[model samples]
Target: MTLEYLDYTIVFLSLGSSIAIGVYYGFFNKSKTSEDYMFGNRQMKVLPIAISLVASQINPLTIIGFPSEIFVFGITFGFHFIGMIFVVLILIYLIIPIFYENNITNCYDYIEKRFDRRTMIFLKTLFFILGYLYIPVYSYISSQALSFVTTGINVHLINTIVCSICVMYTMLGGLKAVVWTDVLQNFVMFFALLFITYIGVTEVGSFKETFSRASDIGIFEVNTNLDITSKNTIWNCFLSGVLLFTCLIGFNQSCVQRIVSLPTIKDSRKAIILFFIGFIITVSIVCILAVVMAAFFNDCDPLKSGEINQSDNILSYFVQKLSINTRGIQGMYMACVVCASLSTISANINSLSCTLYKDCIKPFIPNSKNNNLIPKIIALLSGVFLICSGFVVEILNSTAIQIITTSLNLVFSTYASTFMLGFLAPRIHSRAMFLSNIVGFIVILGVIVKGQFFSGRVQYEPIEKTFSTDC
Candidate 1:
């Protein structure tokens, strides 16, 4: 859908408001110490942080990717809720208290306290590198979304503008700005989805009809297959979902920073609970939207009709089709995608800055004051680096380069296992934990190489094209 002036105005208003928030906090209630900048002085309330958690966690990829999965695969992916519940329980009972009790700024700090400085240093290096690399991917994804709505604007230019705005707020206002801006963006995202879903349902006639159309195509099947390698099986969903969240929410610095930013462990736990509720609700809405889209496109499936090149384009295609008469909906959807990306990128920038300071810089500068300037500088530079890297990603869009990058990313997954070892098996030797990390990296590398070289390419069944005379 082409965005007109009104749509652009709405999107800019949303983006400008976020920067305005950062300016207000950065100038008026400026953070006094590194602690205040990094942790919000540990005085933040539960509700806003809960909202921020959802905002940060639901990246642009999830906004588009989840809906695509539902549209193409089936509702079987919804079974992840089962795994999410188990992960939340584990985080509340076993993981969060350890970080909260110690009052640590960065999650990696816990590794130092539990094991040794060497182990912390090792993991910190890995995290910093991975964090830096991943931010560019987020920027690229966000730019792609913006490009979809505004075909006149260059994607790289869009990337630079969005990254600059995020850096301005994050560098100026720090964590508090990031959290509050996230709160605002979360509402925009929710409203966008809700409005789109309403329009999609009304256009499809009724909810029952939507589901009936989807069910007719076997989209309601829940795969209960026992095979471990079978994707989307109930067992696979529950087990892999638990492990993924344990890694993502439990060990990741971005998530841990938000949890520990609350005043007390009690409040932190409450924020987590509220986060889960909001998360489940938002996800359910997205899944329902997917079903609605399936019904809306039952006959004119975009992929089959060649209206879009990829499944990920389905949401954008649907928005554009709907926007033929509905004017600002396209802009709102673009804002939603941009909001999701900005929230996640800003959070990572803040968390990575804090982690770099605490784990890498501070140890050597023992007598340094608790100044906020250094972290802000680090965040600014990090943001610039991410923007530059987006250009690199855009230029080097090749399968081989992607394979290498994807393999490197898999190595970071070892953090979850290492974190589990440190938290649950404190009795295990630090040396063993470090060695196991190395071994895990090698094994993952081997697997990636084998898959790239030996495994056959995946082939997907094409959706059958059916024309409707009504259109």
Candidate 2:
């Protein structure tokens, strides 16, 4: 068969497999009630939930964005993990136990019970906005990654196809299918990164040589200086990454939802502990890959090469270059990218569906109305949001990418106090929790509006362009 035909066949088969898995899980093995769909009957094993936790949070953005960050900044980017370790430990000892004890459906439900009704509503709305905004940035990045292999494909069309597939599995099979597929995709994604890193380092020469070049370029320094205004300084990363990852690991709906799926709180905590070990590997592996890319293509000067037009394209550039020599490695690489993207999108669609159903719809609908409408509305809206996100991703240009990722990170930062207080110190008033979510969201908006309208542009040129000849 011709190479193009082969590429087309592999892509179609891989995507088809995803759909078949979703259909099998949805029709043949679905839950009898909403709880099963949302939490896998709350009887999930530690290993699968552990795998899905890692898969869900580590999306295409990690595949593309993290390596892209390392490509430009080098080893200084690794310090973000310094904070992640602390955050993960805190969750194991303090946060996960609360959810396990309470048999919580939505994390926000705890906020209401511990705090007040208004506080619950406020926290959920804040998280919903934060999640919607943040997820699409990754969605847009995923679309762009596909564009790397298929040069002229429209990004919106790619997003539509991806988001549609994600919604299908999520809306149909629910978390069961999402987790099952993620287990398989995580292996695919992990091996793909390892393969790319190996090839990249070999292409460039020895690790010592690569590090030498990176140091000569001044990109290898640990950079422990403080500068809250900057994005990547060591001190800034340590401080902000603490809150950023705390929200992500401790309280974000995606991670929390998976942890609760365990058969017991102890198993849930075990999965969380295992996640930390895997997270460290994830951070180290990606950082090394980024450093390798820096060495291999350091001379290519992405901006000079015109590949730096968008920061998200950096990993794709490296992947395409690395795989160019082999017969179908490019196709396999692209499949890996698609799998990575769809895994997170799939988990989010499932999580968002559960959030809307258990947290929003079921809360207000009458007993009869709940039985009649909840599942149908869950399925329909999940499809709608995915389709809408596909279109929304198209309009997300460079500036939008920065605004969305940074803004969502900040919004979730608010959860640090709100969720921690609700879970650990239920004595905190509902008024305080409600006020905190509102204030936290306002703080994030205040920064954005102030920066956009009153202050001059934040001048967040893509990370790679920091070394541009013009600069």
Candidate 3:
């Protein structure tokens, strides 16, 4: 179990391949224009773009945090996948065609046309703020997981080194490089998940034992709570799942960039559907993995026994303990979490730089356009912000999933509701749209300030209790 030569080799190859992909694109497939740099000149294919879309969102949180979320909360969390249907419908029929037909580079461009410049700016501000909050937390989560493997390294050092590599590929290769890199990272992520799950389930004894233990312990208990403020309710998951994904696909500029990068509306719609299928498959693995974890530790319950006090540390502990008999998986697990962080950071900074150029810079600096250097410069500058902000992430006490989902859900929900109104209710006036955005912002901010800050650490009671007889 100490990460052996094979382990380190796997980790290095995973990281190295990501950087090499960037180098290939950076040198062989240089971006010739702003569109080329930002959207691959809208010439990209459906599958890679779809995979990149999935990979962009699948970070350490998805791999590390999601299982813990399901194990602790309940299997009802899977109900959120139901919301993807609404997400795809809106994107395919209501959203993508507009962008494709108009040849819009930025999703917010339509906002400016339909509403006003100020509304577009407001959404852009929220987008950058989200990137700032999310990328660092993701980096910190990766460092924490890797710390379990590479025990000698400082957390901050791990984050900086990995992120620097991500920035190098992203800056040189542009959108094309990031997409291809994501395609590679996505397979690694899935395989890692399945590999760990198989090892864990086998340790627990058998497939039937794992499922039986989970059921007997009520890890499969259903949550019926309909209150929106209540955490992890079937109602809330279903609703937030819909809104969160819709916003992610519908309005979030990073994801929107993926949709707009395709050559035609037909290709864009194909990507959207494929992204949904990919998303369903990923979540299915996480759900099964969570149940498997519950069964593997059924007798000794790591969280309750105080062996792994933190919820997020449970997987790391499981991997560490099981590695004694199995061997070599330590590096694969390391690659999984590290690549998760890399995919997330690369995609966000890449599109976020474009967000800055299109919304923030081009509007004010008239000469910024038709300049390939400016986009790369903006991407480089964003990378600095990405790394520096990560240093602040370790200070938070909550689990990575809680921190990310709370802030992201609040913002995305607001943006989802506020922005969708533009297309759904086209007759609405500019002033009305602006006021709607302000109200949505105020409301979401209130929820965060009151629910997250002032309240004594809010905890949602699990639907079913987990008992460890041996412990």
Q: Estimate each model's TM-score.
A: 0.93, 0.90, 0.95
Identify the superior model by lDDT, candidate 1 or candidate 3: 3
In candidate 1, the residue pairs with backbone N, CA or C atoms under 3 Å apart (3 or more residues apart, or in different chains) clash, namely none
- What is the C-alpha lDDT profile of model 3 across 419-468, one tens digit per residue? 77877887889898788778877887787777767547665676665666
By summed lDDT, the worst window of 10 consecutive residues in model 3 runs over 454-463
Best first by lDDT, ranked:
3, 1, 2
Clashes of each: 0, 0, 0
- What lDDT does model 2 reach? 0.71
Task: Report each candidate's C-alpha RMSD, comma-separated, in the order given.
Answer: 2.6, 3.3, 1.8
Q: Provide the overall lDDT of each model, using Cα atoms, as 2-decimal numbers.
A: 0.81, 0.71, 0.83
lDDT of 2 by residue, 385-415 (tens): 7567766656644444465656666667666
| Candidate 1 residue spans exceeding 4 A from truth | 395-412, 454-456, 460-471
Off by over 4 Å in 2: 1-10, 305-307, 363-373, 396-401, 423-427, 453-471
> Could you tell me the lDDT of residue 312 within candidate 2?
71
lDDT of 1 by residue, 367-404 (tens): 65577777888998998898888878776634322433
